[model samples]
Target: MNIVVVGGGLAGAHAVQELREQGYPGDITLLGEERHLPYERPPLSKGLLLGTEEVQSIFVHDQEWYADQQVDLRVGTSVTALDLDRGRVHVGDHPIAYDRLLLATGAEPRRLPILDALEVPVLCLRTLDDATALKSHLAGRVLIVGAGWIGLEVAAAARRAGADVTVLDTAALPLLAVLGVELAALFADLHREHGVDLRLETSVVEADGSTVTLSDGTRLNPDVVVAGIGATPRDTLAARAGLATGNGVLVDARLRTLDPHVYAAGDVANHDHPTLGRLRVEHWDNAIEQGKHAARAMLGDDQPYDRLPYFFTDQYDLGMEYVGHVGPDGYDEVVVRGDRERRILTAFWVRNDRVVAGMHLNDWDAMDSIRQVVGSPRSQAQETTARP
Candidate 1:
């Protein structure tokens, strides 16, 4: 059987590797729009932006490895259309037929509508080219729009690079969407302690050249501006092809789309999760794990992709990790270990005596236990917290 995987991001690359490892000896084609080899994206904002690692080191595998796996790797090729009935994908002037196809077309950064008015260069660290440009543009003062993970990460990197970093967010606290108010407030303090001038509950009204005007009528001039508001899943391809789509391309628990022959994984897929219901995760771990699961399902070994979602962000010497969905309704019980003042603690979200979600800050040991609790159907109320 011939399989074609579109988009050479983490999910697409992992799917190709997993398919080969699963002993699928048929023709496999990996198509990438980028001219460079498939590389890790997380580091683009962290290590690469900080100049700690070389760009070439981020690749999952070298060119020689692709040849060894006998997978046809097509770089710099854009998939124009997907002919579902014919089982063919159009790439510019060429077309490739496949028995099965995996759509892993990740996400793109949400650009500012007033980007054209900005006089100074605004950096976005989504791709290799973005990182390269942002790295070169780093200067005296760096203004970061949005206080999300990507924005905070870039702020951390730019701060480390000797740039006076300022982060602005419309929410009351940074990461409020994910960590709730209490936890997000602590995160806000962490950034402030690290010299990040974080402006909360603030909106960017406009940008003129090097100056950004706030909704409150405050203006700040910076050498560079980086916007990491968030990402929108690249679902146009799937939506255009008549596939089910909501916030992202809708897929079943097995990672198969409405079309049996077509499947999706990674950031672009809004999977019907076993526990959480429907979710479209953009984390690195989810992309890799889901890609493997989709490949396994494609090989007739159907298995539900129900792994606990986990993600981490490095900011100012703190390793912050989170597991499960921290819904917006707030947690019933919050358990804390260590001191939030010291920036070392693990906050557990309990609902009905069960640990539904957890956020770990500089607490790696608690991750496995937290994962176990999230994975099992154990109630938080069942376990008593021993006083120290």
Candidate 2:
């Protein structure tokens, strides 16, 4: 069987790798828009921006591995269209037929209109090339919009590099919608203590060159401006092809689209998770595991992909690991353990008196305990030693 995987990011790369490891002796073609081989993106904002990680360390596998595996790795290629009826995808005018196809197209950063209208370039951290460009401008003053994950990580990197960092957000606190005001307060305090000029309930009203006007009538001339607002899935190919799409390409629990021959993983797939309802995860762990899961599904595995959503981040001295799903207004109360003032704590999101999600900051050996608490009945979780 011939398999074609689009998007040369972490998901696509892993999907191809899994197929080969599963002993599928078939034709595999991996298409990537970027010129570089498939690479992990987490370091783009963390270690790469901090100048602690080498560029070569980010790649999934070397060119030799692809050649040895007999996988056709095509970089600097774009899938112009998906012809589901013909079981093929178009690269410009050329059509590549496939018995099975995977769309790990990932996502693109949401662009801001004010930044787009400016004469000077407003930076974003989505690709490796983006991180390379932003690293040079980390000195002097850096103004960042959005206090989400990307924005906060960038602020941490900039401050560590000796730049005066200012973060603006429309929400009352960073990650307010995801973590709620309770946990969001921790992040707000973390950044502020690190000397970040965090402006909440603020937005850019106008901009020209490097000068920006805020909603509160404050003007500042920053050396660099960045937008970490968030991202939207790149599901245009799937949508135009008549595949079901909502926030992303709609897929079943097994990561298979309506068409059995077509599948999607990573940030571009809005999976119908069994217990968590519908979720579109855009984290590094999801990309890796979902890709591998989709590969097994392609090989006729009947198991549903039901792993809990997991993500980790490092900012300044605090490192955190979060597991399970907790949407806005999803949980009733947050149970805290350890000392919040010491910055080492584990917090559990409880809904109906049951733990639905949990996270830990600077608590290294609590992941196994966290996984036990999340997705468990309160009585069952209480039996674990790591109870909140």
Candidate 3:
């Protein structure tokens, strides 16, 4: 049996590695769009951009691992079309037949319509090349659009590179749409302390050369601008193959597509969670777990991907680990424990008295205890206000 995994990102690479480790004697082939082997991307804007870590530290595995494990790792080759009926993927001129196919096609950075007209390069950190290009503009004036994780991390890196950094977000608070206002305030505070000119309720109106005019009529001259806006799922191949897609490739609980022969995981897959309903997670932990989960499901295991969504972020001296799911509307109220001033606390979002999601701001020891009762109803004692 031949297994073909598309998009040689962390998820696809882990899927192949897990399949081989689990005693699958089938021939495995992994395809990546980039020349580099499968590498972890989280560090690209953080330690890697800051020059704190080397390139070798970010790779999923060395080049020799593919040959030793009998896995064909094809780099710089793209799978443009998926022929579902014939069980084959169109890779350039040739079509590779597969018994089972895993679509780990990752997401691409979303670009603003104004970027096309701009003479200066407006970057987004998604792949290694994107990071490398953005790295060259370091130590210059950086006008970062969006105040999300990518934007904040890039701002942090740029500041470390001695660049004049200014972050602009249309939201009244940073991460307002995702983490809500209070936590967003905490992150905003962290950046402000680190000498970042954090601008909120700001929108990009026009981009001419290196000058970006804001909606408030404020013109700023930045050597380079980065739009850390979000990502769109790379699901054109799956759609061409007639697979269901919403925000991403829609898959059932087992990470199986409408066609049994095809499966998708990671950022490209909008998985239907047991508790969270249909949601697409674009974090590291989900990619690793879902890839393994999808591979197990393909190998005859029927257990659903029931693990609660988890994500973490680090900026300056602040570190956060958030677990559980927070819906689009967000929770009713936030409860805090410990001290925000001391930077050791846990914040929980209560919806109808049940703790839907919880985040620890510098408190590393509370992860296990927080995970135990994350979905459970919160009591009155746990509703006290604490600092961050």
Candidate 3 residue lDDT tens string, 321-388: 88988887578988888887767888888888888888888877778777876888887428533343
**Predicted model with the maximum TM-score:** 2
- Mark the regions of model 1 whose C-alpha exceeds 4 Å error after superposition: 328-330, 375-388
C-alpha RMSD in Å of predicted model 1 compared with the true structure: 2.0
Q: In candidate 1, what are the lDDT values of residues 1-388, reduced to their tens digit?
A: 9999998988989998999898899999999999988889889888998888998899989999999999899999999999999999999768899999999999998988885688888777789999999999775899898999999998888878788988999999998878777788887887888899999888888888777899889999888888889999999999999999998999999999999999999999999988778889999999999888989989987778888788999887889788887554556766666667767776777766567787678876777666766634435423423223
Candidate 3 at residue 68, lDDT? Answer: 89
Global lDDT of each candidate: 0.85, 0.91, 0.88
TM-score of 1: 0.95
Model 2, C-alpha of 117: deviation from truth (Å): 3.2
Better of 2 and 3 by lDDT: 2
* Candidate 1 Cα lDDT to native: 0.85
Q: What root-mean-square deviation over C-alphas does model 2 reach?
A: 1.5
* Number of clashes recorded per candidate: 7, 0, 2
Per lDDT, the best of the predicted structures is 2
Return the number of clashes found in candidate 3: 2
**Candidate 3 Cα errors over 4 Å, as ranges:** 380-388
- Tell me the spans in candidate 2 whose CA falls farther than 4 Å from its real position: 379-388
lDDT of 1 at 287: 91
lDDT of 2 at 259: 99
Worst 10 residues of 1 by lDDT: 379-388
| Per-prediction TM-score | 0.95, 0.97, 0.97
